[model samples]
Target: MSKQRTTQPITTGTSVIGLVYDGGVMIAADTLLSYGSMAKSFNTPRLYNIEDRILLGASGEYSDLQEIVAKVKALALQETTNSMESIYVDRKLPAKSLWNYLRAVMYQKRSKMNPYWNDVVVAGWDDQADKPFLGTVDKLGTTLQENLVATGFGGYLAMPLLREKWRSDLSEGEARALLEDAMKVLFYRDCRASARIQLAKCTSDGCIVSEPYELDHSNGWNAPSMIRAAGDLDGDGGW
Candidate 1:
């Protein structure tokens, strides 16, 4: 008998989010790669800066994510070298074009029944249009653009928060605060999520990815004694 095709991923990351503010776009993802239920890598970054204008956040199989990043980087390098004058002449590919190219690649893989097993968020400044773009493509090659986007568990746990708070006039500081708050919610609720997060932004000037850092949760709310106290107050007998 012929073996059936396997669609499941071996290892994965989870809960990446992106949003657009008045001046730019921001993306965030935790640094955890899980092997099933086992927490394998505690510091695996799933967000990348592409072409100095795009910030890509990926969730799902790490190998597949790496492959997609490599493809984009290679294409960007070729475009930069072979069409340097075109780039200066404002004929280079913008963020929307890059996003569409990536979506096409993902869709082609899916049509061949060998999808990359990833959900990727692309955030960037569309220099040609002179505005920010934030969008996502899924394993099935489905794509969407919106003020906010999240993949994996973040879509469920954190998207609602963003949807409720996102505004067209949001400043960068305000948008980053909302994103961080959503990350905190994901960390508290998602078993596969971690405290360490990587954040990046794409603006008209350039893209910048901050070094990984752990969110502060030391305000005693996570303490067992606090939980017990709240439980006791609720008369649940501190079960």
Candidate 2:
């Protein structure tokens, strides 16, 4: 006789951004996992290197993301004949393939009326044409786009900035600078976004991750500064 184990659902927090460049793609996300509206933890890496070429950015419920990650890991293991070496070398498990698989998983979950409530951005080089590709997949298994994408609170604030500066022919440096600026904007505007950010670039060569960097808000106006600058520090302009 065996005892059945019961599992409690896990929830996580995140925000993500992705943009395409001339050579490949760039994606970024903050590392703050929240419990409700409050920041509960930090340094949670939402970006993942699923295969040699693909990168994934997950946002929303942490438990759902973990389950998806686990599913991908298991599928990779099974498809590789249980050989680690084979899995690494095989090109069959490319990013696009993984994207389709994920979409299916999400769609099935939605059909069952128990969706994961998470969104993901998949960025990588198109294996067949050797071109850059960026796309998003939500809980409903919908996948679309490459120019620019965002998830969570940053989506509302960051997407506008992205559209303003985005260009399909941007150089790598230009694209990176644009993204960094956008992140800065998000940090200042979006309540969920923190001053710290983690960024990654995916090219034909591979993925390059930056050390987490913090945003400085010293130049921005605070309540005291606003009051002082308004010539009403004591609430009496006559002074």
Candidate 3:
């Protein structure tokens, strides 16, 4: 039997964006999962709360995303069970440890010529380091740690807005507002994106994933620039 591997990803999710705020870290993603060019699933959230204060948001192969998180959870459970009779303190995996584990996993798979085909955003508060943690790991196992991180379309469409507005002292409310704006731009530009948002936050208080909600579009799209842009697209027909 010949060994087979995933050569292409199907039923994929779109961008994920994360930023560290004053008290902790926050991440956001659209709820739409696309199958090729079709808008397939609207309620499947890409954000997963793996453990206390360890939040993961991923874009690309939805099945692979679920599989990776499940494997992590299983590994943690097994390790915890084995250590139950031991005298080691802090059995729960720290954010940095988890991030490193993921890097290893992704890299190993890539070396085998099989990859998860996902771009991930991991957010948490590193209590020992007394700082917020925000990072990204790609299908190729390349890793990045940044105060503000965006994946997929969000990296192109939303990063500028985040870079322009993010501050070290930003309040939680301010951070959320910035995400809301960035997501709206993504919805407008990224064809695979959804108006619905899945938000997660990890602070010293622990991680919380919010219910999926739609961007408030009541009157926000009535701007003169949007109207003129729409008119231009309708009027131009050189072909």
lDDT of each: 0.87, 0.78, 0.88
Clashing pairs in 1: none
* Candidate 1 weakest ten by summed lDDT: 84-93
lDDT, candidate 1, 1-239, per-residue tens: 96564489889999899888989889999999999999999998888888677788889999999999999888887777767665454344567777888899999999988899899898888766889998999988789999889999998999999999999999999988998899988988899999899999989899999999998867636666556544477646763
Residue clash pairs of candidate 3: none
Better of 1 and 3 by lDDT: 3
User: What tens-digit string does per-residue lDDT give for candidate 3 at 64-124?
Assistant: 9998999879877876777787777447766777788899999999999999999888888
Q: Mind sharing the TM-score for model 1?
A: 0.89
Q: What is the clash count for each candidate, in the order shown?
A: 0, 1, 0
lDDT of 3 at 89: 47
| Clashing residue pairs for model 2 | 12-62
- RMSD values for the candidates in order, in angstroms, are 3.0, 4.7, 3.1
Best by lDDT: 3
Worst 10 residues of 3 by lDDT: 230-239
Instruction: Kindly indicate the candidate among 2 and 3 with the higher TM-score.
Output: 3
lDDT tens digits, residue span 119-190, model 2: 988888776878877888988889877678888776788898899989889998898788887877777677
